[model samples]
Target chain A: MIELTINNIKVKAEEGMTILEAAKTVGISVPTLCHLKDLNPTGACRICVVEVEGFKNLIPSCAYPVSEGMVVDTNSNRVRRSRKTIVELLVENHPQDCLICVRNKNCELQDLSERYSVREHRFAGESKNHAIDISSASLERDPAKCILCGRCVRICNEVQKVGAIDFVNRGFSSIVTTPYNKGLNVSDCILCGQCIIVCPTAALREKSSLKIVTNTLASKTKYAVVQIAPAVRASLGEEYNMPAGTDVTGKLVSGLRRLGFKKVFDTNFAADLTIMEEATELIHRVQKNENLPLFTSCCPGWVKYAEGKHPEILDNISTCKSPHEMEGAVLKSYYARKMGLKPEDIFVVSIMPCTVKKYESARSELSKDSIPDVDAVITTRELVRLFNMAGVDFTDLPDDEFDNPLGESTGAAAIFGTSGGVMEAALRSAVFLITGKNSDNIEYTEIRGNRDIKESTLKIGDLELNVAVVNGIGNVETMIKKINSGEKKYHFIEVMACPGGCINGGGQPIHQKTENVIKRVKALYEIDRLATSRRSHENEAVKTIYKEYFEEPGSHLAHEILHTEYFDRSR
Target chain B: MNTNVLEKFPQNDRSALIPLLQEIQENYGYLPEEVLQQAADHVGMPLCTVYGVATFYNQFRLIPLGENVIRVCRGTACHVKSSANILFALETALNIKAGQTTRDKLFSLEVVSCIGACSIAPVISVNDEYFGRLAVKDIDKIVKKYSARKVSVSTANENQES
Candidate 1:
């Protein structure tokens, strides 16, 4: 431990802890813009400058280590002046369009400017004006708003391992961009959107479908239907004053209904359907001994990454459409047939905790007759914006249930929002399919939590099942290497592109603290615990859908709608 | 297409990136996007980082190089000697601004900070050969000589091709 006097408050901090972190322990909040938690510090942004007694110049507290008997004043006149100067310089170059920015009140820069009480720009210079890039359907990049914090660049290159974008050029001409400033669509971006979440300003954001959904709702000729993903339910409450992981599924339904949606449905229902088809497929693959390790295709980001970076393993990925895609297909086909409406007349909008789903919805494979299965994909953040824009009293709204047959789901489906959830959900039913009875133990506790890679082996009656789960795309390379080297063998693998699964998805509310993600994960687990039917096979609506329409889980009709193919997009 | 430039560097060795990029710039005059991507792949670095490093160093250029390059020094000594006027004079003569190449690719202009020959104030280096103690009137003479040389070089290339 190291001793430090921060603002005359003597404290002992752990060795190697930065002055910013030590100050944080003592509740001395030093504002920072470029320090990503657990990632290597860049200290590019000099916002957290502090006055150390021995140091000649104001040191960046975030990058400076706390030393024994170090005298530090975080908000001293000298430090405050330096920090304010930094903010002034950043603001001078930045655009003055914060009111119309997507990140408005939630922006870190705005918060810092307000904290520092920076009312006037002292350093006036020629501001940079760059064209806003809306080339990718999933994300938007406004280079003019970027403060050159390099947070997004680091996240993309280091954490996500995509390297889709980077800081190009030097000095005044420096900007974060793809190679040659080309559109992101041409780059190897998986569209996971981790960069958007890390962005301190409105520079990086998901391309919003809020306006389109509003137009669709207002259109008299179109019947707009919306489906909410499981992760959306787990984290949507954070947008409001409600605490993180406060499952507002019922309130979310009420809010969406107030948004003027014709019908509200749950993607969890399709998650159950995914389990039915995927479990049966796994059973067949296990018996036939073909495609030994079947990789889950639920995450569109992971799917795109696999296709582009590792096309050799494309065949190993499950052919089933993602839950939301499956829901859209079923809504267009089965639900449309039941409602006596043409597929073209019904517009489907999915409220997803994913930005990649926007790109996935536009893919040609997930469409029929040139009509996309999902017409629009709005993120959980966009849903909050819609709620706020429509003046919906989300907190006061009564708990409302989801509509009809497509809304009903099981506890196994509810757990699909977190890491290792798909595998656990599938195993609950896969064990039943192989042994004609549910597993005595339902919770696959071995494969739970935020671990990057998780694997477990179990004996289901006569068959030994081997399964693995990968949450972040960065953790996938090692697993693929093991599979190729014949060192690790598995019959099934579940991969969620975002770390800690969909609850911490890129499209969810931005959280700097890890506790919010944990709470969201716990909330999904709580839903599973409280649910009546804990297995996908036990979902009566799913069973009815199979018996009355598809005939069987992997029947020809089910394959036509639920199953999809992948392509080799390796560069 | 000259992947052989990357062959000297060990695969996945990030330390080899600077040397490899230096060699690329030495061989190709400017780093091409395709070659930069290949260097990124060979060095196991992100393409953006490769571009970042290349741009951070003023020695590297992204666009195609012209036949004759003119680098105007804007060092303290040169600035004191009114190098800005000489830069403007050159820009007018070449019909291009600093950090740009002429449409005919005969000459390119770049304003640099110190080429380490401060003894010769207001130095202008054309293709690594330094000319010192020059005035605004000297810009036209220098540009005309480079233009004349470019014509002869092209004529020789045309003769060889025929």
Candidate 2:
């Protein structure tokens, strides 16, 4: 440890630690914009400039290391003036349309300007007039409002490993965009939207589907049926004043009902259905020894990535539609028939904690008879905004139950919000189907956690099952290489696009600190533990639906409605 | 796109990016989108990163250059002497803004940092020929002269073809 004087107070900081990290340890937070934890600091924003004794220039604390016996003044008059000047310059080039911006109160730049008390710009100069890019169905890009912080670029390139956008040009002409300034639709963007969460301003955001939902709710001819995803109940409370990971499932149902939805359903029912189809498919593959490691097809982001980057493995993926997609299909077909309404009259809107689901809903392959399975997808953030717009006090609402039949789910479906939840849920049902009894252990702790890639072998009766669970698409290259080399063998694999799975999905409420993601992950686990039924096959609604409608899993009717095929999109 | 051209460079190494882009730009007058994608594939870099590097330097162009290029210096000396007014006048007369080519492809305008001609106060260079001590009134005459030269060159080519 090295001793230093910070603001006239003597403090000991660890060796090789940056000044910003050391200051935080002493309960002092030096503001930063481009300093993302666990990633290399770019220090391009220069907002964390601090004064040090014997140094002529103010050093960026985020990148500068602490020296022995150094004296640092983080809030000196000189530092204050310099910081204020930087804000002034940034504001001069930035647009003053904060009142109408998407991230009005939540923007980091707006927060910084308010804290620094920046009223007017001192040096007003030429500002770039770049147009917005709204070609992609999942996301929107506005270069005019960008502050050039490079956080979005860093997250998209390094964290997601999908460099669909980057800093183009230099100096005043620099803007973050796709190659040749083309539309993002033509680019290799998987529409995962990880960039939207890390952006400091309204430069990047998920496309708003709120207006369409509101219009559909007011229409007399249409009946707006809504379904909420499993991850949303774990993280949507963060948008309100509630703490992160607070389970607001009951309150969420009440709030959606207040918003004038005809019926409120749970996507977990469809998740249970997915587990039934996927596990049965896995067993069939194992018996035939055709496609050994059957990949999960629940995440739209991972599905699209596989379609684009590795089309050769398209056959290895399960044919089951995602939970929300399956829910929309069931709602339009069975629910519509029961209610005596046409599929066109029933507008299915899904409240998801994912941005890629919006794009997935628009896919022509997921549609039947030229009508989409799901009409619209609103993120958790959008749902929060809708509740606020409708004057619904989300936290104060009374606990209510989801509508019957489609709303009921099992504990295994609730855990699907986390990383290894799918693999665990599948094993619970696969073991029961293969043998005629339940396993001694239910948790299957081997494939659980936030690990990049987890591999395990378990003996279920006479067969030794090999399985792997992967989170974060950035960590998939090595596993793909290993699989291609035939060096590793596995019977099942679960992949989620976002790190930590749907609980930390791209469309969750934006939190500067990443700890909320961990909290959300734990919340889903708690929900799973408290439930009565712990397996997909045990879901009463699922068994009833199979007995009444499809007869069994992977049946002809199930294949037509619950299952789908893949396309060769590797261009 | 001539993707076969990328096989000449070493694959999967980011260090080969600059040289690969330079060769592409040399082969084609400006960097084409398809060619840049090919180069990105060769270097194992993202297309966005390749585009960012290509756009960072003013030496690289994304579109083909016009027949006659006009560069207006906006250095400190020229800016203080009202180079902004001169640039605006040129844009008005040509009906095109800076960093854009005219519809007929006869002329293009660009804003440059400095040509080391600060002694002249305001300088506008056209096709390597420098025009010093420029004024707002001089834009029309310069554009007319270039327009007349282009017409003459086209007529000369027509005569030779016939």
Best by TM-score: 1
What are the per-model C-alpha RMSD values against the true structure?
2.2, 2.7
> What TM-scores result for chain A when each predicted structure is judged separately against the true chain A?
0.99, 0.98
For candidate 1, the docking band is medium
Flag regions of model 2 displaced more than 4 Å. Answer: B1-5, B71-90, B110-146, B149-162
Model 2: per-residue Cα lDDT over A1-571, one tens digit each: 8999888888899898898888888888788888888888888888999999999999999998898999999999898888888888888888899999989999988888998999877787898798989999999999998888888888888988888889998888889999889898888898888888888888889999999999999999998999999999999888887889899999999889999998999999999999999999999999899977889999999999999989999999999999999999988887778778899888999999899999999999898898889999999999988988999988799999999899999889998999999999999999898997888888988788878998888787778888988888888787787788997778899999898898888888997777898888889888989998989999999998898888899999999888899998977
DockQ in order:
0.73, 0.84
Q: lDDT tens string, model 2, B1-162?
A: 456568778899999998888878888978888888888888998999999999997788788788999999999999999999989999999899888889889988999999899999799999989999988988898889889988998999999999
- Those runs of model 1 whose alpha carbons end farther than 4 Å from true positions after fitting are B1-3, B92-97, B115-120, B128-133, B148-162
**Per-prediction TM-score:** 0.96, 0.94
lDDT by residue (tens digit), candidate 1, B1-162: 467888888999999998998899888888888889899999998887888888788778888878788999999999999999999999888889888889988788998999888888889999978999989988888888778877898899999999
* Docking quality level of the chain pair in candidate 2: high
**Candidate 2 clashing pairs, residues 3+ apart or interchain:** none
Query: Model 1, range A419-468, lDDT digits (tens) per residue?
Result: 99999999999988888887789899999977888989989876888899
lDDT per model, in order? 0.90, 0.89
